[model samples]
Target: MKVSVQGVRGSIPTSGSQTTQFGGNTSCVTLMEDGRMIILDGGSGLQKVTLPDPEVKRVDILLTHFHLDHIQGLGFFSPLFDPDKEIHIWGPSSITHNLHSRLNRFLSPPLFPVLMRDLPCEIVLHDVSNSSFEIGPFTITSQFVIHPGATVGFRIKGKSAVFAYVPDHEPALGPKGLIFDKKWISGFELMEEADLLLHDGQFTTEQYGKKIGWGHSSMEDAIQLAEYVGVKRLLLTHHDPAHSDTKLNEILDALKSKHTGQLDFDLAREGMEIELG
Candidate 1:
């Protein structure tokens, strides 16, 4: 399986010189192999996606939640306007609203110039919960996680590799902080023993102290979870919009200096690609 990072920033788009190296676009990632494409999230980085070959007739996008930073680029994704393409979107289901209704709140007039119903492509929306499904050659599991609203984390299994994504998790919200027992941890099943895990590392420990329930995790917390889950490699994503390239590097460097474990981990950067087997 091949994974590509299109956006790493969290909360809002922060395109500027200060964030050039790590990128300022919000959460989006792509997995491509054997002519199949699977997109995770639809943030401002959705605009950065290059369409797959014409032979690939369908593409599926799995969204974590309805947050603006996660779905803001749906209207700008060029392929959505292509009449010949077929697009499938899967998102966390709500008791009061279906997937289409929730998405319409953003793709309708006033919020967006075009309405969801007006898109030229054949768009299909699927409501997901604690379920498993398949798209092309990949098997996916989507489950609710500890985040604001109806957010979910995804576990994707290819022929030879596994990848887990949880870009807005706050599993350490309680006083105990990230229970060591896997059975009690949020999103633990999605990440356990995966080849690569991309997770939220949006705040520093100091910042997290002030925003306990903001649906984001500190870098330390992210690493701790990844280590506990025994993932082979960890990519810390969802960078705070306020963290500049220099500041990000400084924080990572400090963390690395104190880290003595053999775990392979690093901050996720836009355009970075990893081929897992």
Candidate 2:
């Protein structure tokens, strides 16, 4: 499987010299295998994704939640305007609303100039919770996780590799920290023993303390979870918009020094690509 990081920032997009290194777009990633494309999230970075082959008319997008930072790029995604494309979007649903109507709330007049119904593409919306399904060459598992609202984490398995994505998680919300029991830990099933894990590490320990329950993880929390899950490689993503490149570098340097030789880890940067098997 081939994975591409289009955006890494969390909460909101940022700009300027300080943010250029890591990029400023909110959460979006792409996984491609067997000429099939699976998009995760529809953040501002979604506008950057392009269909490499015009002949590949089908595309799937899996959204973790309806947060603004996660779905802000849907209106700008070019595929929505392409009549020849078949777009399938999967997301969690609330008791009062389904995925289509919820997404329409954002794609409607006041929030967006073009309504979702006005899009030219053949769009299909699927409501997902704890479920397993297939798309092209991939088997995907979606499970509810600890976050604000109906958020989910995904485990995607291709022919030769497994990739886990949980960019807006807060698994260590309780005073006890990450629960040691795998059965009780949020998103553990999605992350366990994956070849690569892209996870939330949006705050520092101190910052996390002040923003508890804001539905993000500290770098320490992310590292601990990755270590516990036994993932081969870990890429901490969903960078805080306020954290400049210099600040992120400093944090990475310190983490490397503190946890050297324990695990393979790095910050996920926009435009970064990884091939796994």
Candidate 3:
């Protein structure tokens, strides 16, 4: 199996010498298993990828939520309009509307020239119910996350390895203004012992405090969760738009020093690929 990081920036895309290394596009990733593809999130990063040819067959896209940065690439994804191709989308249901309707809102005329109903490819939307299900050779499971609108973290277990993706989650803060115990621990459990975990690390401890309940995690919080889960490798994702590559390196250096040999962690970079046995 192979996992590729197409984009990692959070909120919006940024451009500057400072962000050149890790990249400036929003969240999007591609996971390939047994000749099939599974796409996670659809941020600006999706625009960076070249979709497979129409004759190649359909793929699955599992979404965390419908935040603007997370779905901005939906209309730009080339394969969606191919007559011979199909795209299956799975995501948490919204309180006020179904997933299909929400997606339609984005693709309708005025918002975009092409309406979702007019797309040539078949688009199937499924409202995930927080349970485990099988998709080809992968076993997938999801859990609710603490975001403004409901969000979910996904764990995909293939024949030989496990991969977890959790973006835009706030490590629960208690009434006293500290990390909530249960929510923090539960997030770790969702990533426990995975071969690779791609997680949100969108703020510093100070910034996270100011944005409590805004649904994002700090670098320190991500490291602690990595330790708690005992994951072999943790890739810090959903980088803040204002963070320069140099600043990110500084944060990583501090994490490396603090965690030492307890956990393996690194910042997620666009174009990076990891292969599992």
Candidate 3 lDDT tens digits, 16-54: 788989999899998888777788999989876765444
Ranking by lDDT: 1, 2, 3
Which of candidates 1 and 3 is the stronger one according to TM-score?
A: 1
Which residue pairs of candidate 2 clash? none
Quick one: how many clashes does candidate 3 have? 0
Error of 2 at 119 (Å): 0.8
lDDT of each: 0.94, 0.94, 0.83
Model 2 agreement with the true structure over 239-276: per-residue lDDT tens digits:
99999999999999998888855789999999999998
In the order shown, the candidates' Cα RMSDs to the true structure are 0.7, 0.9, 2.0
* Lowest lDDT 10-residue stretch of candidate 1: 50-59
Q: For candidate 1, write residues 82-190 as lDDT tens digits.
A: 8988999999999999999999999998999998988999998899999899998999999999998999999999999999999999999999999999899999999
TM-score of each model, in listed order: 0.99, 0.98, 0.93
On TM-score, the stronger of 2 and 3 is 2
Candidate 2 least-lDDT 10 residues: 254-263
